[model samples]
Target: MLLIIVGTACGAPDTTAAEGTPETLETFTTTADALTVQNCSPLPTSSVLASGDDGAGSVANNTRDDRLDTRWSALGKGVWIDYDLGSVQSLSGAAIAWHQGNTRVNTFTLYVSTDGVNYTQVYTGKSSGTTTAAETYTFATRTARRLRITVYGNTLNDWASIAEARVCGAPATGSSVVWRGDFETGNISQWTSTQMVSADRLQVISSPVRSGKYALKATVRQGDDPINSSGNRNELVKMTREAVGSEYYYRWSTMFASDFPSVKTWQLFTQWHHEGSSGSPPLEFYVYGEEIRLNIGGDPGTLVWKAPLVRGQWQDFILHVKWSPEASVGFVELYHNGQLVLPKRNIATMFPGMLNYLKVGLYRSDTVTQVGVVYHDGWIMARTLADVL
Candidate 1:
């Protein structure tokens, strides 16, 4: 959800009425627009790990209260506050208003983590030290769950303070495991949007789960065109829109039902669809008769990898790709159930000038007579293999 943070000495601005959920950015506001801004949105923020607080007025909530007069102040150096985005996200930067920004500079470092155990430092610098107004700090885009700001005292003394702050989300490119569509929320709320005929087509179930407390049971019968699209599909989407030069690792598990249609046609379970929407996706994971296949390019794309399909058994996959339109620069790698099924192979991962987004569920040629069912869970996208593992 986008939130507008007005940098006036007054208070926060009146945001648009789209405060329904806390993720869809345009639903609120932005930071680059200096006059109106937000404390901790574009990415939702909730304190996860924090040092002791100074007092009641100086609580951690003050950092996001939309008021410059109130601050989250604490004594001594090395004090910090961490925010959990509820789910992994592609974070780009941070906007912070120091406790006494106009008077003193606060030395601080920015760190991020996936599981909240191991942290990686992303940015380190001092606040503007000139204005109590919020300052924006940019860094290389990264994928993670939590953001922590550690302060090492300001210019005045060993006192750490933050009037307001926020971690910004990069809706496009990222390196680490930035998101999960594992049905962890007991629903499909984690995804950017959906293309389902009905909620019943894509359901979250507790039993028959591969990991976590739930799994998605996607069902599709013939002629189920939820969005009145060309093909029959019931899918949940993650709008990655990964740019050229971007690389990422993805992990997920899927199981086809024993009664899944075995027609000698394409039944796509997952795909990185190009934005052009006119032809086959650049990359796709599908079932062709009794075999599972991974294809790259379009139409009659090159089949990079394939294996015999096994029904009623969880199939785990870790896919690594460098998203480039050039064959020499882009590549794809795959590991199935902990085995190196496909080594890194250079190829064009995207159509030139076109972006890609994720769709996972059951999409297939609608001519088949039998119903199709598939279970999916534990979907994660990261920059490194270790992060998804």
Candidate 2:
């Protein structure tokens, strides 16, 4: 009997799958007006200095000298490296660690400087050549004292090594995280999913995580099929960035499955969707029978908030929002577990020109069959709320 309709747009729509196209909205900007540095530190040593190296465990301080069997190599094509950090400092992100980096792929470019000769590029990608582990890379926090790395060749030879090199940032006061996914390097390669059809839905579990060691299991059965065939998905990850009009501060941690299945049609476990064409999802959180609702959509949809789904522990969430489709500049707040349960509230999260993108796992309705399981953990995305509460 699935009918909780608020403003319409819910259910029915699977004309044989395939629909995704929308996307193309851009316009982000908001470093919160920059310049905040309230006591930053971290950059004690990495005074590296290279343009050549290839001797004694591969020199250049073996990439910060942490030793994963040591390395720094460098040989042809543009190769460079620097690190200094004696002052300006206020950056955010960089983890590196690639000696064989799982055997290949590695193009790079990241720069920042306060004087090591005036640089400033910030980042450029490529590196999942997974061999010695490490990997992490985040950006958009800026402020620097010199940290360069420019490779430009890899997929095998021309060699650029680098076995360890971290940098992370803090001490800049007003918060700004912008993406995090605490799988702690056990790997989910960060995350992105169009509803991956099975590798067991999505995984990276170590023991149920709330902090670290890894956690992000999804799993949804009942025929599990609907990557676009309209609803009945197995969700998995989905956050390849996209949020407009700024103001974010999400956080995460969920858990369920103590038999979890009090279905009534519609199960969504997190969403923000909207990029247009086909509705419902201006925000959602879902599950109706055993409570735990939120929805939002527009033109009549609203369910505001709800709770009471207990099952098996771990909940936590933060969500701040500000986005906008204008209802006097959108709003929404919520805490749960840190308790502020839905405070600000104004609505209109988006649907004009569209923007908003995020997704978690296990969407339902297709006549519920059962077999679901959740368990996510520390997925951040900040810009304050003290960088994801």
Candidate 3:
């Protein structure tokens, strides 16, 4: 059964209609319209090089040569190829064509850099193990001059080979910021918290912020009071302003405490809950040990994606969603630490006659006996990808 922790008071009259109502439905658009403007393919002036050349015919240059007959090959694990874009440029995505593309799945990590010496990991995951065709991977837009691909291993062999590699994106045009909650005001006056007891469930802390002097801290301890007939939670809900058919891009940073519990029970950090009822949220971002999961609510429900939940460090997220109940209209695209982990996927984002609202904090099952803490900062919402990227 889905045990949800409601943050509001029990029988709290639906205040959404009394407060600000949701916006009206708007036109539906795809992410391609924004991303295609940047050209996410390999640049003509870009230079390609790699470690451990295979000598026969496969070389680093082969991957960029645009010929399927040519391939870049390296022996053993931990092989990598570097792409120098000739100058710093905005990058939105990358595409790779494996030599034996359909044969075996490959594990790899994509890194970006401006100075070539210092690098940041943007994406890490396994490929679909498809052959012959180029598989495209996308992420939030970032400015960089160098791109690196590190291959750890593959499903079939230790050899790493690529038929082609391409990068796509255009120069950055800053996105418009519609809302922000950096906690620079020294308090969470900009947000509304749902605290059931006098205990400090939510507070503004001074440290561990991505920027500014303050960040929102949520603490959920054993014996903490419950709310709205749900389990103990310390959550902040952004006032309801979303309606069906409206699209939004949200960006935020989150960090799990060092002592964060690893219970098998659900522990929600963030979710887009329907405004109609106190039940499973339409979209949930929760944790299970180091694994972060995204659950889409439905008759049977659906698990869309899961990634490593890196603790101790702040992880950035950019989410683009078009809210709707119809599978053809509603969609979700998730970027983790700038990497496009979940591409635009069609899903039911809302229930019939229901709008959704944003909530962020810590809410876990009663089975969890240990205290839970999570830090949040740099919250923003915008209308376009450029705004949140």
Q: Candidate 3: minimum summed lDDT over ten consecutive residues — where? A: 30-39
Among these predicted structures, which one has the highest TM-score? Answer: 1
The candidate scoring highest on lDDT is 1
Q: Candidate 3, overall lDDT?
A: 0.71
Worst 10 residues of 2 by lDDT: 30-39
- Per-residue C-alpha lDDT of model 3 across residues 35-75, encoded as one tens digit per residue: 11113333333478787778897889777543556788998
Q: Which stretches of candidate 3 lie over 4 Å from their true place?
A: 1-175, 226-228, 298-300
Candidate 2: regions farther than 4 A off: 1-67, 74-79, 82-146, 149-163, 177-192, 196-221, 225-233, 236-250, 253-259, 262-315, 318-336, 339-359, 363-380, 383-389
| TM-score rank order | 1, 3, 2
- Give the per-residue lDDT digits (tens) of candidate 1, residues 46-133: 4545686787668887675445666777787889888887778778777888866899988999998888889999999998789877
In order, candidate lDDTs are 0.75, 0.67, 0.71
TM-score head-to-head 1 vs 3, winner? 1
lDDT of 1 at 119: 90
Off by over 4 Å in 1: 1-175
